[model samples]
Target: MTDFESTDRPYAAFPVRIGLQVQPQHAQYADIRRTVAAAEEIGVDVAFNWDHFYPLSGEPEGLHFECWTMLAAWAEATERIEFGALVTCNSYRNPDLLADMARTVDHISDGRLIFGIGSGWFEKDYDEYGYEFGTAGGRLDALGEALPRIERRWARLNPRPTRDIPVLIGGGGEKKTLKLVAQHANIWHGFGDAETIAHKHAVLDEHCRTIGRDPGEIERSAGVGNKSPEDIGKSMLDVGTRLFTVSSSGPDYDLGLLRDWVAWRDEVNGE
Candidate 1:
């Protein structure tokens, strides 16, 4: 048996959740706002945007909005669905400052913020934004150092977070990233097909064992990239992935896929 199968998976207790990534590119703020509202109305469990200065897809120089600021606006625009960047780059802001910003947003959203973060990538963002384009290992090390500072900052904030903000770290690196996920994340977001994701889960579970943390304590999240729920959702669910995200890019933030995923989630959860 694989390491994950050898142990009991307490993740069955977590209900299936659907997330929509409202890609902040090629669209106006109004379109993005409307999309977030629609996703909330459709009963998505979370809304997310990526942390990037430019578009990751489609016309590279296309219109784009900053991540955290848009998230703060999402806090005010939507009422129920939790929201945050899919993964904020650790190199962009000071850990303490980021913590304070997250705390403020959490309070604004009435504790609905999910603080998803990761090591820096997308070198164009670094070069254009005037941040250092460090080695990948250096960025990972920085992320490792920043996580604790962020937690400590939360403790010291004036009117601390409304609740302990859930930290969602996104990446699939088996060594440093998975270990960091075991050490700090409440949710681990990865990108892959079922076999790939199942392998990552096993690695993550092993990391949890080394740290003496329960593997089930960390939620598993994956992207539903153009695949129908009937095609890939059951396999992902069988591997203990409870959060499935669909990404909608703007000018037209088509949510047809999101609707399918939401229906699938409800069906699987017996809602």
Candidate 2:
């Protein structure tokens, strides 16, 4: 759906949508499913899985998983947590087909899906998948074209998204990427500590203003480790970051940090 109506009032509190980007690179599907179910049951706001082939941090050729199929399963299994790929590569699928798949999963999840995506990166995925590993600019150009087609296809899909499917784009590229987020993303996810994230947030705002769109129309999010959630959370929150994420992975994916962040979310919400 339309991201939001442009507004002039002071922006509201960023919703505490905790994201757990469960890496599938080193984990079995059943094990990963268990981890996802547990997190949903534990009151996580968002449950995410990375769209990757090899383990990002562990064994390079470990037991890995594809993104869309796993997300389809996640949609059916979890009833609570909003689920999606942490960011799907724009090059991997035709944008219209991707939109249709997202719509189908939206129905399957009864509208708990977030259409998270990004311009393709990771040369390995491109090489292995046979997608052109072109320049970064070319990939972002693909994304720019794909997003509108995705939106258009969404309108023509037989069954509309059960709920407005939120488009979540993750990146920190200042030029085309941030501008795309301003134009299309309902949520822009960034990976950085407080200072880096704050800088990106301002850049995103400038992009929005340049396009005549209000920056706060999109939710600004960042992913950080749980080691300093308190300080990071307070710091990012001070600078307009509402969505904070801690990524987890493995055969026995732990939800300990996730629970702690949930408590932190309550404390902040209480304040």
Choose the strongest candidate by lDDT: 1
**Mind giving the per-residue lDDT tens digits that candidate 2 earns over 83-109?**
888899889999999999999999998
lDDT by residue (tens digit), candidate 1, 1-271: 2222212566655788999999999999999999999999999999999999999999999999999999889889988889999999999999999999999999999999999999978999999999999899999999999999999999999999999899999999999999999999999999999899989999999999998999989989999888889899878887888899999998988899999999988778777
Question: Any runs in candidate 1 off by more than 4 Å, and if so which?
Answer: 1-7
Candidate 1 achieves a global lDDT of: 0.91
lDDT of candidates 1 onward, in order: 0.91, 0.82
TM-score, structure 1 vs. true: 0.97
List runs of model 2 lying over 4 Å from the truth: 1-12
TM-score of each candidate structure, all chains considered together: 0.97, 0.93
The candidate that wins on TM-score is 1
